[model samples]
Target chain A: MTEVTQPALTIDALGKKCPIPIIMLAEQINHVPLNAVVSVLADDPAAYTDVPAWCRLKSHRHVGSYELPGGGWAIHVRRNY
Target chain B: MAYFDAASTEPLHPQAREALLAAIDVGWADPARLYNQARRAHLLLEQARTEVAEALGARPDEISFTSSGTQAVHLGVLGTLHGRRRAGRHLVTSAVEHSSVLHAAGVHERDGGTAETVGVSLTGRVDLDAFAAAVAGHDTALACLQTANHEVGTLQPVTEAAEICRRHGVPLLVDAAQTAGRMPIPPGWSVLTASAHKWGGPAGVGVLAVRKGTRFRSFLPEDERERRRVPGFENVPGIVAAAAALRAMTAEAAQECSRLSALVDRIRETVPKIVPDVEVIGEPVDRAPHIVTFSCLYVDGEALLTELDKAGFAVSSGSSCTASTLRPSHVLEAMGVLTHGNVRVSLPRGASAAEVDRFLAVLPGLVRRIRQDAGVE
Candidate 1:
């Protein structure tokens, strides 16, 4: 169900709270093609656990998640190619 | 004492204090009795009902007293859902409702009723279209929304929301804990709940009003009391005090609300400007006039609250960690605003402009101290 908007993925989930990052990320991933990288920026602490669990369950790769400068965080996920 | 936590509980108005003391003996007897003391108690209770109903924009027959706002909300929500059980097991509500309503929703879910939390924009307004969608498809038994948030003071569009619920044949229950004595609710609210403490009345008194046509049922176990709605003996003196305080508060609400609104507007305009990296939360225009909130970047919320208290200014805050297992404020987080280090200040009724000035003077330094303590420049 990937939209494949671009092979180079862009998902801006910043300012989104828990379940939202997962929800937004899921929506964006559907648009991406196989093997695409999606960047997610979220501030919610729950997103830290939710995103990876979503990736693991969906068989997508959670490339990584890191703290964003100035109070938020960044997460990267790859679609299952 | 400088109590800025009016959101938590306002100082009892002078009239309410007088009423409570006077009623301790006079209204103490059971109205169910035949003695003169009982007759006096009956008169006082009836008068209190009239006064409270008028202040709350409700009818006497519709308003029933609860021991606290939390109870009112619980009874209102669970009771309504139970009454409508034949309709469906699904309910809809906003994300930023007070813990009372949210807690009721949890109970509803546990009881096998489905709960769908509608999203609120960062400014704390419900997403109308999304809200409609949540209630649209399902057998939505009821919808609950707060007239104004207790924590951030953001006002919700209850009137419009009522229309949406009406369209989908859903009853909207409004928790008016913050707005009851301030502004009148929209015409279409099916059931409404409020706390007297939030508006300068003593604790232990809450108001629940159900529209005449609403097919709601009480959730509490059977008793001849409350028409089988709320349980237990009524707090007669507390009800007297609630009625008196509501009357006194709203008598001057017109001028006072405007004055306080302007004062809070000043705080909204000045706080972020004076304190660097501080981001004020809530919609500037759509919020109640007595409260304002802001999150200071690199500042610790608990520390800011403590410093303010030490400086002779009492304020309130929901610690970031306490917001959820999730984050600070779902409303702030939903809005995508800064959520760290949030502080909510609610001005007391009858508070002076001088107090606001004193608070403004003390706050910047307190925030700076907090920042320093947090090891932020």
Candidate 2:
């Protein structure tokens, strides 16, 4: 996989389950500058399906998910609004 | 593995299974037909009706079978509302009624009728004062309440609410889907509904009982079956199985209730003590014997259920956020309790004490692991 630009903000959602990870991303999305990428690290299986769905529902951009070296996933979303 | 979702549906009782198999050959013919075979089928159907009616303390003439408990509730709510339309169009029900009753009330509203939803308390019991006030309105045509709350297992004040409705001349429809066959239904309800599957009977059989004097107009397209209340050919075999199961369960209810109540008490006492940040929902003293519900902070109910299932325990979660439905449980929300990460453990008939102990022993660690996986501090 190719390396992407470092996110403007990193959310440590690892071990966090759904809605929590989604809620964290939502609450902190605006903390970063608009259009900046925010990375959420989470392992909860629900996060895989829910994060992207949340992005679509909230009209944010789900950049994509990447793997963390230690395991789990790094879900990327861009603050659009 | 412990099968602890009886509130959802019980495994078929042995009596039900035997009755179902035996009746299949005898009940296959149309009961409406006049041949000798049909005569036997008709007899079977009548016998099943009598069994169910006797179990429910209602006349066989008043009980009609529907496809499922949800169907029975729809028929009960809509039939009563339509029957009393001339009196007024207002319907009264609880905020935590099963989706069936709520959906029928929604239809009533869409059809230009009005409905008042009474709220429940933190313990998930209906507020009698609010209910009485709601039913007291002269324009209220019907009031619906459940014998027990399905999600949290808290018994409702059905008899008291029924008295208020009676005083107001409003018919009270009781959804006894969770309590029927497990206990004697309290008296005074004008109409009652229950699902066969909830009590170890076969699926596809639901009972709707309308007291003889209650005003209830059939809303289905004109039909001769089930007094035109529920239209379509009767499910004779399933009905036979359901009635047989009802008889068996009712016969053993006193003993089963005691056994299950003790198990539930153990769980009620143990879960909070062993698992931190867990809130046990439901009225401890006034709840159903076979069911208990609790919610965990900082954990996902769906994930927890998955872990439990993997560990060989089949249970259910009340959290709406757990699955496809993103909306939280209206029952929990109505009670003003935490809706996140809710687990409802309902013991089936014959659930063993050892199984309950095994589940209790494994639950705390599983919940802790799930919380850790969620990264909740």
Top TM-score: which candidate number? 2
Clashes of 1: 5
Best by lDDT: 2
Q: What's the distance in Å from true for residue B3, model 1?
A: 1.3
Q: Give me the TM-scores for chain A across all models, comma-separated.
A: 0.81, 0.90
Provide the TM-score of the second chain in candidate 1.
Answer: 0.96
Residue range B126-151, candidate 2, lDDT tens digits: 88999998888879899999988899
The residue ranges of model 2 lying beyond 4 angstroms of the native Cα positions read: A1-81
Tens-digit lDDT track of model 1 for B213-301 = 88878876786655567887778899999999998888888889889899899999998778886667788888887989876655556
Q: A9-41 in candidate 2: lDDT tens per residue? A: 999988765559766876688899988899999
Docking class of 1: incorrect
Could you tell me which residue pairs clash in candidate 2?
A15-B373, A15-B374, A15-B375, A16-B374
Quote fnat for model 1: 0.08
- Alpha-carbon deviation at B291 in model 2, angstroms: 0.6
